[model samples]
Target: MKTKITDFFKLVFPSTYSEVAVFLFFIVCYGILGSYIAIHYRIIFDNRIPWDAYFSFDNKSILMTGGSFERHPLSYYFFNWVREFSLFISGGKMDVNFRLTLAWLSNIIITLNIIQVFKYLKNIIYLPLWLSLLITLFFGVFSTNIILSFTPENFTYTLFLLSLYNYYAAIKLRKEEKIPATALSLAGITIGGLTITNFVKVFIPLIFEKDLFRSWKKFGNALFRVAITMICFIVLYLNRIDFKYQNIFSKTNQQYEKFSNVKSMPTWDMIFSFFFGGNILFPGFIMSDKHNMKGFNFKGLYMDLYSSVIPYFFIAILLILISWSYIKNFKNKWVQIIIISFLIDIVIHCVMRFGLHTSYIYGGHFVFVYPLLLGWLFFTYRTSSKMMSFLTLTVAILCTYLLVNNIFRMLEFFWFMENYYQ
Candidate 1:
């Protein structure tokens, strides 16, 4: 048992000193930010109104340990267990300190995501050490990620799991090894359990693994594993809610409409500003009055084309680079996987128009793809010295701009929360 436990620990943690250093650095940075946000949240925000209008999150449900279970079936139990453990540790009292503890834990998860980004770039993508570090830093400073690192929501956990899944799949592909059914099922359960839609991403690796279209045996095996995973998820979900599944569909349908109806802008504007650009760039922050609500108002941070054209400029450059990478590396299997996973988000937010208004908050689901795809650009042009230099220079400028813009915006948000959120 001791040997097995030690092996598992090694499997999960960073093995190299450099990886450990990077992990520690992010943990401390995000930990301090999360603590500051949690302190403000406990003092200012009322527990009645949902926080979605503010930070694009349901902070009331998350803070109260009763998550939106219809959509995230397992999140309620997960947070409840954390709350219980925290209560036990605090001798049955919950206070600001308890919120701070949860925030710090979330910071660890966010840090781990940064580590995974670095690992995937260094090990699987096979980029240079300096380029990988630069891209990882770029991902770390994303406007959405700064908010996610501190917000105690399912999205933070989902980001970590998705990064882990992608990294695992990349390693398997690099090794030319078939992914075991058990591994696939486990990935399905954890990733799908958090957000049901993400379950599709877990199975995408299987498409590249084998010619399921040509082989009935492989197709049947994949179907059986998927069926088993679904059965297990249903059983666990039912058990979690004491078999009260009747109202789930109705509740979810209601929520789907409420969340998806935020089509205030034109479709193209929404796609460019919120869906793609807002995830990375810091947009104008605006607060509006909600007279119907007793003590709070709605807050939004999004791009306003009328206010500035800088966001569009950055978005244009990013899209051009990603398009170039895709066209150049269309034959690369890993590139295909990353693009497919990214397209899933585009379909959901841009095509289906689910939560289009606040699509920036969903950056955790697909923002990592930007850096990964960028890495492929470097990989593709590795032999061309001029192209490599140009790509490096372009990425550096973008990263620097993102870091400065996002950090300034984050500070503005903190000031707003401190003085005005109430």
Candidate 2:
């Protein structure tokens, strides 16, 4: 039995268990630390962290109102609407419990969707545990969607991950010429996610590709696409965001975002932002309160303006750094797969960060690239082996610190529960 298991590991995994085992240590950090941070955001930050320093301090009253982004600020209303609708059914009974349950339920959907994305990638890409662990660690810290927790962005990110999985499923199904029932089902699942918010804005067009959309014999693909969209719309209405919320729509605002495209910055700003832009390496800067925008010249859009510069630098540096390596080992299938995945994600999300498609990974879509890059880097190259071990240790120590903080918070929650329930 031991020999058989060893053989299975050798066949399925890219490297020895040394790296993967270390990564597991980090997972303990992420789960415990991440959960605590999330609850803290709920209790202390109210609904925002990573950026709660500004906008509506409310004398530390702890509320979740408007978000940082205008496009999704409507989500603020949506969550409240959820709380209100629950009250109607509760008839004022167990009102606090109902609101708390809804809040948790929202996060549950996002977390489960992330799990599904990893599961899908595991089956299709055959990534190893070490790869997934390293990537998940990056997501836990830096990804805007994950960092922002319990918001529309988080929900949209979940759908985005699901949409990618469904996309890959469709690709396989189409190759087989007859769409599989399971693929159809998964495709249907993502449509609701997309409609709830523009989660897969960049890649939605790929779903309705010219060939796929034009072909009637490919009715399964079309049906799956349309079905999910309609279902998502229905959900939105059922959640009470139909024509009644027409006031939320804005013709002028929508037009600016869609048509009046912003130009990408020069190469220098892009490079500067990568190191200091606060997306990674230094995320606190973007969320810092010291740089108040209220009095700044570019007041309304300072965050968006500055944050957009980093990914271009990442793309340039990444390409230049990887150039010699790629040229030297062009024939390697593993290298090709890694490069393809990165490019596919970039191309699929080009519009998100102006015209520079290569930069999208540094933007709100960090989760998409974090896993793919780390997976490919750790498994494809042997250099990361030692670094991975050190990172694991670092995260474990950090997690211990985080755990003590969580105990206090958890005690606070318990105290509140006991006093309130009684």
C-alpha local distance difference test of each model: 0.77, 0.40
Off by over 4 Å in 1: 1-11, 39-50, 89-91, 210-215, 241-246, 290-306
For model 1 the local lDDT of residue 364 reads: 79
Per-residue CA lDDT of model 1 for 125-214, tens digit only, reads 789888888888888888767777767777888898898889888887887676677788778777877787788898787777657678
TM-scores for candidates 1 onward, in order: 0.90, 0.47
Clash pairs (backbone) in predicted model 1: none
Best by TM-score: 1
The candidate 2 region of ten consecutive residues with least summed lDDT is 54-63
Model 2, C-alpha of 284: deviation from truth (Å): 4.5
Reference-based lDDT, residue 117, model 1 = 81
Error of 1 at 55 (Å): 1.9
